[model samples]
Target: MQFQKKEQYRRQEIWELVKGKEEKISRNFQQSGYERIDDNLFAFVNIGYQGHAGQAFPNQYDTDTERLLWYGKKETHSKQPLMKRLIDGAITFYCFARWNDDPNFTFLGTGKLVNYRDNFTEVFNKDGTQTFCLELEFDLGDNSIHPAWINNFDASFEAEPPDTKEGKEKYVRHKTRERDPAVVKAKKDEFQKEHGRVFCEACGFDFKKTYGARGDAFIECHHNVPLHSILGETQTKTSDLTLLCSNCHRMVHRKKDWLTLPQLKSLMERN
Candidate 1:
């Protein structure tokens, strides 16, 4: 496959690109199932079904807009360095899937590590069922519409990595955001005192107006300057913050050139 990880392609186009170009690979590439180049691994699977072969391992790879659940071999448990490599963040995993027998696939993009489980699901075979030991889940960036339903199974971890010391430390160091609740509340109170009620400063969206009791006084605050971008300890003022709806707050930081409140409101009005 002349595959660029970022581009979408139909199965026929993939076959056309690889055909006769490389004698080592099958002319019909996606049929080959898996490919690897150094530390990068890509797998193309037929969604919602399993291959009927004389095998004991699982092949039920399921994906949605938000997640991609992959299975690995149990026979290689303790023997496989893959378990450690995945958690060590050494390998980049990519996956593409087609619903049932479709001729095309959706590029699932480079998967970010979520966590893996042991003995997660059972794959039935001719003789009996095989309980898969290595089950990996990944976080795909956004969520919304799904193209098709192919075994939309509930994803869960039966057992996490036996060595979670490094994972735990890494999560705390990187994923946890440093935000002061006192400052956020102070800004909210300031807005309510002046405007008579706290609502999105940019869009003037009243959460309670839409969600009723569930969204009462539920307005999100976005830093005019991102906290991460600031170096060292600095004082935060209410003027440095803007009250926004959850949607607007996310949109503000979605791009590298962070949109100002006026910019967002202008775009909203134009559309």
Candidate 2:
């Protein structure tokens, strides 16, 4: 989803705009709508699914659109900023996917949630009127593609919870390999040496040795989607990569609130 910060707008207005007329907008729907493969056999796989929804906001904008921006306190409200609205839009899209009926569908990554504060900005217009537009953009293949699925054997409304623990145990993944800061750094360096020129794919920036006498510049490499399910016996190319900074990477993992790469970029510009 993408937006240009312009003026006061309601969360509902953005929601309505992104919530397409279709019942479900998934990759499966894109590849091939509901179809019968054989007798008693039907498949609905929407790999390109992103969820979005509304959260808590007490203070409401009196504008006709009912737009309002609230901080920690719900009642005290103001105009919703473009960045927040865009993130909310991405969240809404991701949230809606929970209702999809595809056995081989997963979100951008581990299907985890992320949360962060939106940074706002004000741009002036020719009429001397200030307009705030929300901006957002993402590379779906990297951020939202995973091995998560939703299945309905009887076409029922019930959704069976996934075996998260079992999947983890069966995968035989090295938990430490994935999380150890040293391991992450070493692997990143290795990839850079072999690939040549370490830079963020989403936003170009080289690794910095230090910053503010405290930190260094670092780039994160993320699979545009997940790799395990599509890993063995088949190799995906580098084009299937989405690189991000620490901040952007964390935001990508926002559970209840998130934004795509494109969406995130849009928000940054507006801010």
Which stretches in model 2 have alpha-carbon errors above 4 Å?
A: 1-196, 203-205, 209-218, 227-234, 256-258
Error of 1 at 228 (Å): 28
lDDT against the true structure, per candidate, is 0.55, 0.33
Off by over 4 Å in 1: 1-20, 26-33, 50-65, 73-79, 142-271
**Candidate 1 residue-wise lDDT, 154-254, digit = tens:** 11111222222211222331232234555566677888889887688888899888999887767866667754345455667779878888677657754
TM-score for all predictions? 0.41, 0.26
lDDT of 2 by residue, 141-219 (tens): 2333221111001111122333232112222211200111232344455667776755554455555533432323345
Q: What is the C-alpha RMSD of each candidate to the true structure, in Å?
A: 13.7, 21.4
Q: Candidate 2 overall Cα lDDT vs. reference? A: 0.33
Point to the candidate with the largest TM-score.
Answer: 1
Q: How badly does each model clash, as a count of residue pairs?
A: 1, 43
The model with the greatest lDDT is: 1
